[model samples]
Target: MSQSPPARKPIIEFRGVSKSFGTQRILDGLDLKVHYGEALVIVGPSGTGKSTILRLMCGLLEPDSGEVLLGGLPLQAEQLQRKPIQVGMVFQQAALFDSLTVEENVGFLLYEHSKLPRTKIGELVREKLEMVGLDPVLARQMPAELSGGQRKRVSFARAIMEDPTVPDDETQLLLYDEPTAGLDPIASTVIENLIRSLKQRGSCDSYVVITHQETTIRSTADRILLIYQGKVRWEGQAPEIDACQDPYVRQFFDGKIDGPIQ
Candidate 1:
């Protein structure tokens, strides 16, 4: 008797995806896969469709051609309703509401979507805040009252607050779209360390981080994929970035003024 084939695990996959805006093509026949329980970092120059990939992954935008699959299934509206996957996304800028206090902002999804009492949600809010290495006192402050780093940290807390019931096998997938962009070196380090600590949380199965920062790339990536002209120019493990021989990868990682990138 013949044995059955090994089963393929569920994870995010992009199959020959292509997208265009008016006349400019953002992604062209791009194929990528993000494996479960791995930190996949996508890095490239600006305007190379890095952010677009995240949007497509989360169903914020649809590709003009090809498929975006989440958990071995197409990310269609109907499929999403039948079997929802927990996803947490952190935007480039800390997109917090100016009017709401930090606690309110963190618990906004819970407050609106669930029947949980405000006090209970507040407690959960404080929990997430602590996870991000933030003070509980900062919860009462408005967005305007906090510094850039504080705002970004609050955003992280909010993204993670919605799902508390998923089991270890059904862990949430986190996506970071330039989580440390436009912050001071110290503040950037804070976010990088937070990303580094994600595996310990046990609730997150995998993550996809899109960033161009060298430090963030080095510290957060388990595997790195370099995208250029809407295609994956180079791919390797984190330790292999410096040793990559591709001209585009060399130029980008080495910070050379002259190479094939231009």
Candidate 2:
């Protein structure tokens, strides 16, 4: 008899989750799973709760109903600030502090919370910057001194930095919100390649990316999920995306103007 392969394990699970802001429901009775060693890219029209999904997973937001779980344990929103789960986030706008230098920004958590010496923190900062394909010299510069792409890269560097409080194995989930948005083709390609390279390097065991860019969707996703009207409209492997016949999936893949999306 042939043995079956082991089941894939999810680092995080959204079980019957629902979220609403006043009367506007964002996610409704959603069930989603983010597994280990995979890239799951989420795509949808504006305000379809793409970013909200990221927030829920990273514990920035709590669902009005159901639970977000880590290793089958429910995650509380307050746990995020304690760095207990070791999640890294690349925000939509990069979210750099204008007052801090690149080095300071990348090393902010370590500088504030870790007892590591300043010289050592600076070295780690340089290493992360270089890993992101940025010059270490940029570390001395401010956010305003960099281009949009550079800022995004710096944000990535910051996300990958180790939090001393969290165990090394705990830092396996990476969440990106609109990582490639508002960039030129070359810049977008850079972000795409970076995502692939990070996967290749095993920088994180799993990544969840929220993006609207087609190139990003094609390049970064091992699997794809389409959210529409507070639900998962479709989901499949990246290559299967084009052949999916669901009307919403078809409309999104073809960039159609007249569809249920609107």
Task: Give RMSD to native, each candidate.
Answer: 2.3, 2.5
Off by over 4 Å in 2: 1-8, 77-85, 164-167
Which residue window of length 10 is worst by lDDT in model 1? 162-171
Q: How well does model 2 score by local distance difference test?
A: 0.88
Tens digit of lDDT per residue, candidate 1, span 89-167?
Answer: 8899878989999998999998878887888888899988999999998999999999889988898888777645434
Clashing pairs in 2: none
| C-alpha lDDT score of every prediction, in listed order | 0.86, 0.88
lDDT per residue, candidate 2, 77-172, as tens digits?
A: 436444345678999999999999999999999999898999999999999999999999999999999999999999999998985545765646
171, model 2: CA deviation in Å?
A: 4.0
TM-scores for all candidates? 0.93, 0.93
Candidate 1 backbone overlaps, count: 0
